[model samples]
Target: MSRAFRIQVSEGVQRIVHVEDGVQGTIDVLPILAPERMAELLATELEKRGYTRTDQDGELVLVKVGEGNVTVEVNVRTGTVTVSIAEEVQVNVSTTASGTAENIEDARKQAEDRAMRQLEAAVVPLQEAARREATARLEAELAEVRPELDAVVNAATAEALVEKARELGDIESIEGSAEDGNLTIKVRV
Candidate 1:
C-alpha cells in the first residue's frame, strides 16, 4: 500500500509583490519564487547543517533544515508544503490458527507488513507539518525585505512613468490593485 500528502503554497507572489510596491505601479510582474528553487534552497540550507534530502516518489523530503531536526515535504505541481518531525513506529503481529507452522509464520509476516504500512501512513503527516514550518519561516523573512524590494521596483516604475508622461502629454488616470499582498498600478491615457 502507498500514501500521499501535500501542503499547498498557493502563488503568493501576487500578494508579496503588492505589499512591496505600496500600491503605486501598473505592471503585473510575478516575483520569482519558484517552488523548485524554494525547495532546493531549503534542502541545501538544511543539508549544510547536516540534514538529508530524500527522494520519496515525486516529493522532495527534507529530513532536516536548519537549527532543528525537521522534515519537509513538497509537492511539485501543487506547490504544497508540509513540515513535521519523523519518529520510528513499531509494528506488532499475532496469529491464532490451527494450521501448518509455516502458514502461521506467513500470517505473522503479513500482519507485520500491514503494521509497517500503517506506520508509514502515520509518518506522512509529520512530514507535512515540517513543510508548513519551513514555509512559514521563509514567508516571515521575505516580509522583512518586501519594502526594500518595493522601493527598487517603484523607482524603476517612476522612471518609466516620467518617460511615458513626456511622450503621452499627461497622465489622465491612475489605478491600483492590491490582492493577496500584490500591488499593481496602471496609468491611463
Candidate 2:
C-alpha cells in the first residue's frame, strides 16, 4: 500500500532597498578671471549664502543640507551643482503553501516551489511602491529648493560680473537687482 503525505512550506524574502534621485546642472558663471580666481570668488559667494566649504575626494566642494534631507553640492572649480535625495525602504514578504504527494519529499518540494513563486510575484509591486515614494519625495524637495538655488546662482553671477567690470575699466555706476534677474553695469574703458 502506498501512503500519500501532506507537506507545508514557508518562504520569506527581506530586502533593504535604496531609492535615489537627483539633478545636476552647471552654474553659468562667465570666466571673467583666471579659473582659480573665479573659483575662489564663487566659493566666497557660496559661503555667504550658507554653504559650507568642505573637501570632497581631495577637491573643494560647497555643501548645504536643506529640509527633507536634500543635499546640494557645488563643485566650485567646475561650476557644477548637484542636488540629490535618498531614501531607504524595507520590504519583507512571506508565503506559505501546502501540497500532497505520494512521497513526503515530493510534497515538500512542491509546496516550497509554490511558496517561492508567490514571493517572486510579490517583489515587483513592492519595488514599484518604493520607487514611487522616492520620486514623490524628490519632487517635493525640488519644489522647495529650486527658487533658492536660482537666487544663489544669480547672486554669484552678479558679483562676478561686477568684479569683471572693475577689471575692464572704470565703473560709473551699477544698477538693477540680481534677484530680479537684471543687472546693469556702466563701465568706461
Candidate 3:
C-alpha cells in the first residue's frame, strides 16, 4: 500500500488528494488530482445543502448528495467507486393545431412523454448487455488449442481422431465427411 497525499487546493485547504503507491519511501504524485477526494468534498457539500445519500433500489447505491454536477456511486459488493459528470439537455416537442387546440397540445405532450419513457426502457437493457459483453471481452481471452489440435492430427486412424476430439471437451461428435481421401473430418466443437 502507498501513502495518501493531500493535494493543496488553496494555501492550506486541500480540495483533492491521491494515494501514492511506488517506492517504499518515495511518493508517486499523480499529474491529475485524486477522484476520491473530489467525491468526498462533493458529498460533504451536498450534505450541507440538506441532501442525503439514499439506496438506489437494487441496481446500485448512488450518492447524489453533491451541490453541483458531480455525482458519485459506491458499489456495496466490491466497494468500487464511479463518478458521473452530467449536463442538462432540454427537449422541446411542440405542435400547432387549428381546431380543438387544447386537446391537440395535451395529446402531443402525452405522446412525447410516452416516447421518452419507452426510449429509456429499451435503452437501459441494451446498455447493460453492451457493458456485460465489453467487460467479458476485456477480462477473458480464448485459450490456444493448437497443442490439442496437433495431438488429434497425430492420431493413426479415423477412430483415434474421433476419440481425441471427445477428450478436448465441448465436442458433440466427430465424423469423416468424405469416403476416403484424407478423411474430411467434421468436428462439432
Candidate 4:
C-alpha cells in the first residue's frame, strides 16, 4: 500500500429535539367503531393544529412537523391520549474542509464551538412549549370521542332483556315494547 498522508476536517451541528405531551382523563369511549369517521375528524383537528398529513396505518396517525420535517405521532386511546415528536434537524457547518491539516485547525476549532451552541439554542426553546402545545391540541380534539356511552348501553341492554323475557317457555303470553329507551315487558304463565 502506498503511504497516505492526509487530514480530514469537518464541522457541523446536529440538533434533535424530542417533544411529547401526555394527559389523562376519564373520557368515555363507545365500543362500537366507525373508525373511518373517527379518523377523519381527528385528522381534521391535527391539520388545524399545524400538522401536515403524511400517512396513517391502522390506529396510528402520523404527521409531518412544519419546521424540521420531524415525525409526529398521535395515539388515540380510551380515556387517554399521547402526542409525540421525535426528529433531528441538522445545522452543522463545514469549515475550510480543504487540505485538512494545519489550515483548518483554527477554523474548525471555532466552528465546532459555535455549532454546539447553535444546536443547543435551536432545540432548547422548543422544549419549553412543545409539550404544552401537543397537550392542548390533543385535549381539544379529544372532545369528539366523548359520547353518552353509558346511557346507550343501559338503554340497549334493558330493551334486550325485555325481549328475552318473552322467550321464557313458562310464559303463556307476553308483551314487550321499548319506547324512548324505556322497556315494558309483561309475561303471563
Candidate 5:
C-alpha cells in the first residue's frame, strides 16, 4: 500500500483590521492572509517539497476544494487556528479456513494459505509500530520546518498588512510575528 500525508489549514487570516477612514476607504476589506490563499501558498510550498496534492480530504475542514484532499478554511470572527494533515492507510487482516478436500495436495495448499493468513494477523502489531515510527519521524521534521515556514509567512503577512494600511489611509508602520501557531499583526491606523 502507498502512504502519503495530507495537510489542512483552518482559522487563518486572524487579524484585527480597523478602518479609521471608513468613509474614504473601501467598505469591505479582508485580511491579506485569507484562508484560501493560505492554503494555496502552503500547498505550493508542500508541492515544491514533493508532496502531491491529492483529492482526498483528511480530517479537517468538511468542505472540499477542487480535486485535492487538502482543505483551507477562512473565518473573520475566529480567534483559534486549526491545521491538520494526516495520511490514511488501510491494512487488510483475515484468516482462511482449512479445506476439507480429500486430495492431500489440495488440503496441504489450503492449510498453508490459512497459516499465512494467521501470520499476517499476528504481524499486525509490528505494522502499527512501524506506522507510529513514521508518524514520529514526520513530527520531528515538522518541528524543524515550522520555524522557517513561520518566518516566510510572517514576512508575507507583514507585507500584506503594510500594503493594506497604505491602501486605506496614512499608515505609520506595520509590525507582525508568528508565535504559538498564531499570526499577530499590529498596524498603526
Candidate 6:
C-alpha cells in the first residue's frame, strides 16, 4: 500500500534593488553665434556655476553632482540637460505553501515550487513600488533644481548676446542685469 504524505515549505528572498530615474530638457541658447562658439561660451558659463567640464565622445558635457545623489549633465553642443538620481532599496519577501502527494519527495518538491513561485510573484510588485518611490524622489529634486538651471541658462544666453554684440561692432555701453532676464547693449559699427 502507498501512503500519502504532506509537506510544507517556506521561502524568503531578500534583494537590494537599485532604482533610478531621470528627466531631460532643452535650453534655448538663441543661436546668436556659431555653434562651436555658442558651445564654448555655455561651457565657460557652466564652469563658473560649479559644473565640471568633460568631453564625451568628442561632445562637450558639463556635470554637476548635487544633493540626494542627484547628477546633472548638460550637453553643451545639443543644449540638452539630463537630471538623474538613484536610490537603493531593500526588499524582503517570504512565502509558505503546503502540498500533499503519494510520495514524500514529490510532496516536498511541489510545496517548494509553490513557495518559490509565490515569492517570485511578490517580487514584481515590490520592485514596481520601489521604482515609483524613486521617481517621486526624482521629481521632488527636479522641482528644486529647475529654477537654478533656468537661471544658469539665462546667464549663458546673456553672455552669448554680449559676445555677439561685440563681434558685430564696438560695444559703447552695456546695461541691465542678466539675472533680471534683461540686457541691453549699444554697439557702434
Top candidate when judged by lDDT against the true structure: 6
TM-score winner among the candidates? 6
TM-scores, each model vs. reference? 0.32, 0.79, 0.23, 0.36, 0.38, 0.88
TM-score of the candidate numbered 1?
Answer: 0.32
lDDT of 2 by residue, 27-117 (tens): 7776767888778877887788788999998878999987767788989888788888787778999988998899999999989988888
What order do candidates take by TM-score, descending?
6, 2, 5, 4, 1, 3
Query: What 10-residue stretch in candidate 6 is worst by lDDT?
Result: 144-153
Q: Write the number of the candidate with greater lDDT, choosing between 1 and 2.
A: 2
Q: lDDT per residue, candidate 5, 42-152, as tens digits?
A: 445444434444443342222222112222222212211222334444444444445444565666566666656665655566456545654565445445444644544
In model 5, where do residues sit more than 4 Å from their true spots?
1-110, 168-189
lDDT of 3 by residue, 112-144 (tens): 555555545555455455444533432231111
Q: Number of clashes in model 5?
A: 6
For each candidate, the alpha-carbon lDDT, in order, equals 0.40, 0.83, 0.36, 0.44, 0.41, 0.87
Question: How many collisions per candidate?
Answer: 24, 0, 0, 3, 6, 0
lDDT per residue for candidate 4 within 1-189, as digits (tens), equals 443333434545454455554443443334333544344444455455554554444444534333332233444332233333343333333332323224455555555565556556655656556655655555554443233223323443454454456555344543443235555555664
Give the distance in Å from residue 189's predicted Cα in candidate 6 to where it truly belongs: 3.7
**TM-score, candidate number 3:** 0.23
Error of 2 at 115 (Å): 1.7
Q: What shift in Å separates residue 27 of candidate 5 from its native position after superposition? A: 25
Ranking by lDDT: 6, 2, 4, 5, 1, 3
Cα deviation at 181, candidate 6, in Å, is 0.6
Cα lDDT, model 3, residue 88: 29
The local lDDT score (0 to 100) that residue 39 gets in candidate 5 is 51
- Write the number of the candidate with greater lDDT, choosing between 4 and 6: 6
* Candidate 6 local lDDT, 72-155, one digit each (tens): 899999989999987888999998998899999999999998998899899889988988977877778788778877787788
Over 40-124, each residue of candidate 1 has an lDDT whose tens digit, in order, gives 4444443544546667785765443322333434332233444433333232322222212235555455555555555555545
